[model samples]
Target: MTSAIRPPAAVLLPGTGSDEVFVRAVFGGPLAALGLPLTTPKPLPGAAVVDGFLAELDRLADQYGTLLVGGISFGAHLAAEWAVANPGRCAGLLAALPAWNGEPGPAPAALAATLTADLVAEKGVDAAIAQAEAGSPPWLAAELSRAWRGHGDGLAAGLRVAARRPAPELALLRGLDVPAGIGACTDDPIHPAAVARAWAGALPRGEYGETTLAAMGTDPESLGRATVLAYLRALTAEPVREGPLEGI
Candidate 1:
């Protein structure tokens, strides 16, 4: 934790249909415990959601000399995308619940988001939220209820944006060349743990940990700790010999 290596702050993003409130609930205490400041950007409304989140990360990187960026699900994908594009600006990465590696295609989270978007367009936010809540975990249902309402008229557009956005490619991830810690909810059907594991395995210097949505519902910090601990592990792991990770 030398001053030279420690980042000034962590910029965390929330997932589709989620907001800064949830990000705070999950990462606030854990980041605070690390004596690290946390910035949870509010998701932008409408079709430009993905671009807007990436812009927010860019802004934070400019504000601080180096950034430790992270997010949940869709948010995690965006964070990694930015890291891949701006490896020099990234100090490290702390990603949780990555939904997919590249073009979303038929990924469960992407499909769910797209379906919810279409539902919102047809039935309105209230009805769409009700339908989405039907079979979801109570905590998840309650979260969508609150967050979807917060998005209001723009909810559908935002959902569509996330559903269609492409994540960083595996080649881009392999070239990111930054310490990364990935976390996953092993039981999360929408955001599979295997996705997180793949992301961790792709990076030249990365580590991963797992928790469950059930545990996350009871203790939001469970996800945060899993992510941050993995980050610490990646950070402290012996440095790999200097070279391009092109073929790693």
Candidate 2:
């Protein structure tokens, strides 16, 4: 009898103010289809979200050896930075909706996150959700409604930290040799497609794909499938090197 080969393990982090539930919903189906079991850890409030995520990354690496790491928006930035720092450890990188590059500035996503955090802090979660729903598209409104409510005050704090977090430097990106997939949304303003294109362009082994928040809201699998399939294609073209893998 032939034995089944185990797929490499993947850990996906959620966007700012998002939780494991949200990440799982976004990635579970596509990852499972690709034979990867997804682990989405819930980050605690206070302390930079990136810091918490990095700690989780270390923990997961300890457990799994090499890992396939990825995330959405700010989470993507964290994953890319980690991958850059520990090039030999990552099996692959899936950076979805990467918001910006280089040092943090007045990026729209950051502004929105900060603004939303302020709103939540002053007006309260329910009021913030109402305002967001009123201003955003139906799909985004629904997503924020759920994620914001779930996060509560923590969401606000996370946004503040994410706003100040720096993006992976070009030097770091150029150093990454692992297979990478960048998922972008052409219409997204908060997470601009240009940034994704730049990231894909920068990485030596990066591939790019596109999916919309609307699609994700309706069929969460679309986000994962588009991104993972692109990464899988890159992996198939050039497999990961064999070595004693380290932690990221």
Candidate 3:
């Protein structure tokens, strides 16, 4: 994010049981405006979820050099985890709806995923999907239906694995000197706004912004803009170094 350098491409990821379509809806336009081409890699369901994402991130970073990485919820967690391990290869972050700081613990989002996984196991995907859609907002209901069905038979296992996976630790976050922009839905019980602020505070150069599930239900771009604009501010405010910012 220095004057001499910016990531050549961005790879945004989707949350558990979500898909590239949702990732595109949330981040594609904003990144396009910034002249950053976007790529959304689909998650491999079940225990392979984390490793699958890391492998694709490795491929993209190797192909494009430094990468601008970001995502929603577990997707955000995966992006941060990659940045922690590959700081030199990462240009910046645009994390939206971070569910927890480190381990899942009793985080609402994790619990929700765990319960849904159990439900799917007991009642099957179709029945679980029906129960989920009953009172959800029309937009959310539609999204849930599409994404859950899309996960197919792998849905339960994917949820279980993702629910158990830990996000990048705050100690790890402190080491990433890139522009770390964190976003949260203020009204989302699953992803707390405070957790987003904590992530922002943990990084050396970080910014935080707020959107809402209501806004997300209507326009996914509202979530994108909230996160990306914060990233822009962090980028602008970051001090340019005498040497390439590529090396940590």
lDDT of each: 0.86, 0.81, 0.88
Error of 2 at 61 (Å): 0.5
For residues 1-248, could you state the per-residue lDDT of candidate 2 as single tens digits? 99986565899888887777767877788777656888987877754566779998988888888889998888889888888887777889999889888876888998888898888889888998899889888877878788777776677788888887889977779889888888887878889888888898888888887888777667776777667766865777754331321110
- Clash pairs of candidate 2? none
TM-score-best of 2 and 3? 3
Model 2 residue runs over 4 Å out of place are 1-5, 238-248
- lDDT of candidate 3 vs native? 0.88
Give the deviation of candidate 2 from the true structure as CA RMSD: 5.8
Choose the strongest candidate by lDDT.
3
What stretches of model 3 exceed 4 Å from their correct place? 1-7, 238-248
Candidate 3 Cα RMSD after full superposition onto the native fold (Å): 5.7
Local lDDT at 70 for model 2 = 95
All candidates in order of TM-score, best leading? 3, 1, 2
Give the per-residue lDDT digits (tens) of candidate 3, residues 65-91.
889999999999999999999999999
**Candidate 1 residue-wise lDDT, 21-134, digit = tens:** 998888888778777889999988887778788888888888897888989888888899888888889988989999998899999999999998998999999998788689
Runs of candidate 1 exceeding 4 Å displacement: 1-6, 238-248
> How many clashing residue pairs are found in candidate 3?
0
